[model samples]
Target: MLMAKTAIITGSSCIGRESAIALSKAGWNVVLTARRADALKETSLLCESLENCLVLPGDVTDEEFVKRLFNETVVKFGRVDLLFNNAGVNAPAIPLEELSLEAFQNVISVNLVGPFLCAREAVKIFKNQTPVGGRIINNGSLSAHTPRPMSTPYTASKHAITGLSKCLNLDGRAFDITCTQIDIGNAATSLTARMEKGVLQPDGRRMPESTFDVTHVGSAVVHIASLPPDVVVPQFTIMTAKAPFAGRG
Candidate 1:
């Protein structure tokens, strides 16, 4: 049987792109969206599930564009089965003292506002669709639990996502559109290259962070998507075993 009748993956950077590829491999008609058109094209070509993949390039930060993507997905695919709100960034990790208002707001816009808008639109679409339900998986961060030394904007936004996810899970019960959060730790990606060298530890010292392959995260996403609608995991954490997260302070 086909899994995820239809799927959407935002970001499509490291883990997002791989998640799209994996879900496409699982026989889901996938729609790949991001601000980069060329990258989306390249991603669409990298799938192996023999499913029709659409590359819709635009900013998730745009409310109109976000709604249009949702509307068009339902028009093209008949319904939306899963939405991976994975578009995010960690703007130059500097001390909070050095963070300008623009920098802080930009991170919040992309991480928090974008996800909020996307989730809202998805909820509308899922409710209106005949099945009256789907699934929304928010890409949260380990920072939602413990903050790093100088990642104020990223940390704050991720922590806020925890609350958003909780609300969605509770409110989505009636519609059968389950909502879940995946708090991921460091994975091997261009964004986390600094981990190979060293990163800030809880004690204010920089230490090298061991990273697991990005495929492990892809595997986790696949597992989350494979679950039956009746069995929803409200929150899940996927991280590197050797990573310094426990009591990370």
Candidate 2:
């Protein structure tokens, strides 16, 4: 029998949950992680089978916790084929000058450092695994390209993720490991629910924005993950049709 591929999704958010279900249904064993045990349990329950799904609740920002998460994944699945770097947090809406240092640090710790640590561990396993490779998909939110009215910390962290993805892609070439980034915009998750209620815009106006289903992200993830080891999708952007993603100030 062919050994099933395995994937780890961070954040345990709606996108992570949907991607877990998508990958599980596609015959890939999945390990889901996040800070919330309840949320991870909920997501794991949505998978194809509890047997194929492993819920490892932990904080991605904690170095020790991230290490343990990857260790357990490899022990359970034998190898990791994909890592969905989706855990992220946004600091409060405040002008750069007014943004608290603590808030900015927290955002960076979760959105930037967390992915870095996870990718590092995943790359280590990818290099040493019998199959000799894996894919990493980072969730670089829309703010990665353009900033909202008062989203300095969040935007900065996401933009940094772009650089991190590029570096990993270049370095992993010889090892057959691949890195991809998906810049998402207004996916209809609880996080984006405020968009429907009118959100602050760059033009200093509160405008109701459009949102697409988060499952679209999950589908994109599966498509990217399904590629052969030699193939790499370096970057992809998915957003709502009407999202203010084109030439916004």
Candidate 3:
């Protein structure tokens, strides 16, 4: 029943791409952003039947570029109803001592700071729209709760995301903007290929992780988007049931 709604999915990686397609199918005009123009275009094709889809290729790290992305979304679709702050990166699995400061900063830049910047832009646009409130769905990871072995960069970034989401939920209240964080694990996608072979577990072990259909993530995102604006699911985690991410991690 969503009508005349628009959304932006920053860093439309595998999960982001799936989320974008789901939202588009649910009748939201979707703007896709990522580093590569070609990849954005490819993701659009997958959502082909959704005529309102547009691709805006750019790096989320650039503040001006992120601002322009929000501006263009409003220009093209009139107003933004949601922002999927899903752009993120993971460093090669390595021990904490082995992780370089540069690597840590890089992960924070994309996985954490980028969302903050995009959310700021979204707040401006939402404040100006006729229905002056919108939803922001952040793409968090399982690592935020319990990290895998030697994943300091990725884990730290996602944990920061948890804090950011909490801040947004409280601060966005006045603006009628609601923020929700989706913590996902081992969703079958190009980004998780290494996990299929075997992954480092917490108990000083290596085991092949279980996988789940990416479409499950796609449908889950849509379910959240379909909810009434007055309702907010603060945080939800979805992952392969058999995936060693629960207490077994």
Candidate 4:
């Protein structure tokens, strides 16, 4: 009998939730992780089958939690084929001088440190597994390249993510493990809800921004995850055509 491919999705919010459902429908056993049990359950229900979904709710910032997440996934599913390191958080919009250390640390812990822990565990599994290869898809933001007004913490963490993705791509090459990142901009999620109303612009203007459905992100992830082992797409950027990103003031 052929074993099913398995994928673990972190964050279980907006894009993560939609991607989990998309991958599950494409015949992947999915493990959903997030801090909210309720949200995880909601995501699980949308999957192709309850048996194929494992909902483990916990803070990604917790080392023990991240370890257990991988252990439980392996125990339930023989191997992990893909990891969508999608969990991330943003700091409050404030001047760098006004941004509290606590808030900045929280964003770093969740957005940067959390992915590092998860990637470490995933790499170990990929190296030891019989086939000895897997795929990692990181959900990066356009903030990695462009900075908005009063978003130092988020932009910094995302910039770090670009470096991480590049490192993983280079390091994992020998093991047949591929790392890819998708830079998203203004996806239609709660995180970007304020965009429709009006958000701070780089030029100190408050203007509304365009956003596309979160499912676009899900579709992009599914495509990346579906690639053959011999193929690797280092980085991809997806965004609304009209989003104020290319030539921001």
Error of 4 at 121 (Å): 0.1
Scored by lDDT, model 4 comes in at 0.90
| Residue 9 accuracy (lDDT) in model 2 | 96
User: What is candidate 2's local distance difference test score?
Assistant: 0.91
Candidate 3 has its poorest 10 consecutive residues by lDDT at: 240-249
lDDT of 1 by residue, 1-249 (tens): 543478888996788888988887777788899998888878888886435787899999999999999988877888888999999977777877888999999999999999999999999887888768888999998989888888899999999999999998889888888888998888888888988888877677888888878888878888888788888998899888886888532
* Candidate 3: residue 144 lDDT (0-100): 88
State TM-scores per candidate.
Answer: 0.95, 0.98, 0.95, 0.97
Q: Candidate 4 on 84-173: residue-level lDDT in tens?
A: 999998877877898899999999989999999999999999999989999999888888898888888898999999999999989999
Q: What is the lDDT of candidate 1?
A: 0.86
Model 2 TM-score relative to the real fold: 0.98
lDDT of 3 by residue, 1-249 (tens): 546688899865688888888887877788999998888888898884546988889999899999999988888888888888998988988778888999989999999889989988988887778878899899998888887778888888899889989998898888788888999988999977878787766676678887889999989888887788788999999988897765644
lDDT of 2 at 107: 93
Candidate 2: segments with Cα more than 4 A from true spot: none
Candidate lDDT scores, in order, read 0.86, 0.91, 0.85, 0.90
Which has the higher lDDT value, candidate number 2 or candidate number 3?
2
| Candidate 3 Cα misplacement greater than 4 A, ranges | 1-3
Clashes of 1: 0
Superposed Cα deviation of residue 184, candidate 4 (Å): 0.6
